[model samples]
Target: MTGTPEQVPAAEFGPPEDDIARLWTPHRMVYIGGQDKPADDTPAQCPFCRIPAGDDESGLVVARGRACYALLNLYPYNGGHLMVLPYRHVSDYPDLTDAETSELAAMTQTAMRVLRAVYAPAGFNLGMNQGEAAGAGIAAHLHQHVVPRWTGDANFLPVVGRTKALPELLADTRARLAAAWPDA
Candidate 1:
């Protein structure tokens, strides 16, 4: 059921696409690289590993620490798409060592601060998709999403076409947040 990736850009359309769509069950073929369930999907690589090697500004990452890291969703539910990831790549929260748990929380908190400053959101939808039943897109890797929400961030777009509208460009958001870090 595994396959290789064809490198087709998901952004071949006019407007920006929704990252959450990858988690939707019907689009698993496009999201879950073939290794998991299809004939050939992109292999899973530790995204954090790319920072030191290169691709630092790819927007897939917000920040990194000694114990854990925060990566952008590339596809996000909100303008500020981000995920708190532990370097170890374990999925279950309880399975994380006490130190990793502590670091993850601190990183998550920092991410919230950064989002608030850059996006100026009224609130956030912070959560962990524990597993398949809980909506873990990467069921094997534990991660948390920090999504900014205003009074009515949810609009007719997602409800009707399963699409989400992100205003700021990914590069712009990344630069703004990166500059606002530590102080953010």
Candidate 2:
């Protein structure tokens, strides 16, 4: 009594399912594929320099300053994760002019305030990954990360599976942050 292709259970041909639930983040493929990475250290090849040229919403820019801007992390560590970067595309923090430095600091503070207003995170991790050795994804562009951290936010998934489970969409989070942003 051989079963026909249709008669056989569909499960028989597929791998067995495990207890771990899968969180399909297809959008991460852009990062995984390295599509948006700068080709070189020059401003001409930098994403940070290019992003400001586009529209705010499309670029995920939450707020703009004279010398720096705040934008959503396309690949966020958590919900409401954002970055404040200078528009000049300089790699080193010391390279920024006094005006750029002042604005970058202000922008970072504003990002934290906005994140707190919208997400009400218990804590935050705000810093810059300076160079490639320091784990900077785009070492050519200096950017400060503003990550909102909630209690118990670091779950087993990230530790065990090396995957983060973000509850909100990037666009949605960007909109919320942009709306909550204060007037310049």
Candidate 3:
């Protein structure tokens, strides 16, 4: 005999709901839907390439070097998640010139220092997702991710619901990090 909706326990009908609370961050839908992703893999279609052409405030750029720049991630995993990349629009790490490589590394290090000063995170995750197969959202333009981590930062939201809770706005984070950036 088939059980009715009321007859079957709620947990038996579908995935069980946990006691964890939710923030209902509907704003993240845009990122999840890939709204602003480039139409093609060319430099002209890449947001990273287009961002440097505009003002720092508009681009959310924290610091700029001769060949590379550091900016806040538009869709951050954590509060102070930032990305460092060269302005040259190169895809492969081997394609970077010595100057570009140097500036990118320097900017990544400075980003960590600035985030530490501003947020006091317990630790950090710094790495580059080289290509699409390696999990790069934008494989056409290489970028290094620097995500600040604190104790209990990995809450149930991300693990259970695939949503992250950001306490601050992106513009505010950009301004704070930009101000905290160290001199060259």
Q: How much lDDT does each candidate structure score? A: 0.70, 0.88, 0.90
Per-model TM values vs. the true structure? 0.72, 0.87, 0.87
Judging by lDDT, tell me the better candidate of 2 and 3.
Answer: 3
Q: Over 4 Å off in model 2, which ranges?
A: 1-16
> Clashing residue pairs, candidate 2?
none
Candidate with better lDDT, 1 vs 2: 2
lDDT of 2 by residue, 1-184 (tens): 2599799877786545778676666777898898878888998988889899999889999998888999998888988889999988788989999999999899888888888888899999999989999999999989999999999989887787677988887888888999999888
The Cα error of candidate 2 at residue 113, in Å, is: 1.0
Candidate 3 — which residues are off by over 4 angstroms?
1-20
lDDT score for candidate 2 against the true structure? 0.88
Worst 10 residues of 2 by lDDT: 14-23
The window of 10 residues in a row where model 3 has the poorest summed lDDT is: 13-22
TM-score of 2: 0.87
Question: Which tens-of-lDDT digit does each residue in 1-184 have in candidate 3?
Answer: 2689888767686534887565778888898798998899999899999999999999999988889999999889999899999988899999999999888888888898899999999999999998889999999999999999999988777888888989999999999999999777
